[model samples]
Target: MGVLTGRTALVTGAGRGIGRGIAERLARDGARVAVHYGSREETAKETVAAIEEAGGSAFAIRARLGVPGDAETLWREFDRHADGLDILVNNAGIGTSRPFGEIDEEEYGRLFAVNVKAPHFITQLGAGRLRDGGRIVNISSGLARTAAMPQLMAYAMTKGALDVFTRDLAKVLGPRGITVNSVAPGIVDTDVNADWLRASEEAWQGAAAYSALGRVGTPADIGDVVAFLASPDGRWVTGHWLDATGGSLT
Candidate 1:
């Protein structure tokens, strides 16, 4: 039996990239996964199919995280499909890397709505639904800490907010036996960065160079860390910023 046998997990933004990786990994470890996506019905279905094909249980849920009422819609469908939720991965976020001076009100509003607001309320709703000794992993970025990047001022602000949420929420939910933590990744090679990489090979190379491992990270790397956190091994760990950044901050 897998480590998460009989457990149910809900992973948001699971249509593709890191979210899909986390959903698949959790299912593989014996958790019945609820793959939540926004407007990507086909891609979400594909994730579910892959999990089912691997002899794991999974279902797809649809909700736009950045919009109003999206969190409730997600939790309702999650419980409807998984019967109960034991793990919640707040991985859905959106942002744009623009120069500080180029940032506008509309951009900031949208970025905050998706990156900060959605995860806040989603975790609020999902945490209440979690079983005893449940786990909540918030996906953040390395840029939140290292003041090394200037172009992503607005985007970094959202991640910085997530770091704060992870720390504070852990205390609030500790009494209830729920552990909240953040997994901050660096320069992951996901669809989120595909367009940026396409715009400049030099930029991609620069990203790789930042990592001590001399390579960009893959979604699976982040997924594996999240799985460990959700498993029995990570029970004693809470309210920590687990940097799976390939030593980028070093």
Candidate 2:
């Protein structure tokens, strides 16, 4: 049996991308995963199907974030499937590629709403349901520390806030034996970056060069890191920001 047998995990935005990878990994490790998707219900089902096909347990839950009553709706949906939570991965987020000067009020608000507000409320509401020694992993970005792209200023700011939340929440939840941490990823080769990353060989090489490993990161890379944080082996690690950037900051 896997290390996470008898545990329950909830991975937000698991419909696709890094979230999908995390969900699959946790399921592989023997956790009953709740694949949370906003609007991509079909993709969420696909993730669950793959997990089940591999002899793992998983289910899909639909709840659109960044809107009214999102957290409540999400918990309501979650309650329908599971009774308690063991791991919570807040991986749902959106980015604005526009420059700082070009970003409008609505756009900025939307980014913060989805990236900041949603996770904050979701965790707050979920805390009671989470058992002692539960794990909370927030998916942050390396841009929160380094200004890789000026156009993503607002996006970086949201992640920065998330990092702070990770630190503070860890302290508050420590008494309960719950560990809260953030995992920051660099240039990952996911569908979100597929357009430019696959534009040309040079484009791909340029991105890869940013990492000391000289390779683009995959969804599995981030997923494995997150899985460690969710596992018992990571019990002692908390309130820290893990650089899963493949040494890009080096």
Candidate 3:
């Protein structure tokens, strides 16, 4: 139960959904988790409480990402609680389903800002604080590889960029024993997907049918995969993009 004993983890956007699931799982493994939220203070608190109730240790931190000085503010707050970092999960991001023609520069820019730039600068600024042998897990998406949803071209592009970031960052940090990898999930039954996924019986079943598993994924499905990558078992693996898509891409 304590695979990550004595370690510390920071999960961005962990107020709910996949972020919360990752935070809970890390804590369950005995890591003192820092649950970072942008504006969902209440949900952040709920995540902390849930972890604590499960006999795990966790605290909530807030930083509105995709803004100027966001990385600084996040680290500043993190420093107040921890001296160093053992794991960093860049899970904060926004999703869009607009087609190429319908999308504007502003929308595209915001997508890249939150999904791409935030993780880039977060790692850049916080690299020093990450201890040797630490782990960095970037939450990417299966859309990066397949064009199953043409409407998500911009969103998919952002994830593709993130996968590239993971590869290069792993090389840059490998000398220090840090492992960087991208965990790409296909579709999950999270609040973010609730609107469209649950719109109709057909929509729900269609999403489930995308995966060979023949069911909609849950947050825990992705969280468990990240847990493995974050653990010592993943030490030798770096600069790779893991498919957490339940064979959806296969």
Most lDDT-accurate candidate:
2
For model 1, the local distance difference test gives 0.89
Write down the TM-score for model 1: 0.95
TM-scores of the candidates are 0.95, 0.99, 0.98
Report clashes for each candidate as comma-separated counts: 0, 0, 0
lDDT of 2 by residue, 12-48 (tens): 9998989999999999999999999999778999999
How displaced is residue 240 in candidate 2, in Å? 0.3
- 67 Cα displacement, candidate 1 (Å): 1.6
lDDT of 1 by residue, 1-250 (tens): 9999999898989989999999999999999998889898999999999999999998898888777897888888776666567999999888565788898888888899889999998888776678889999999999899865788888988999999999999999999888899999988888878987657989888889999999999989999999999999999999999989999999
Scanning candidate 3 in windows of ten residues, the lowest lDDT window is: 145-154
Candidate 3 Cα deviation (angstroms), residue 179: 0.3
Runs in model 2 deviating more than 4 A are none
Please give the CA lDDT of all the candidate structures.
0.89, 0.95, 0.94
Model 1 misplaced stretches (Cα beyond 4 Å): 198-203
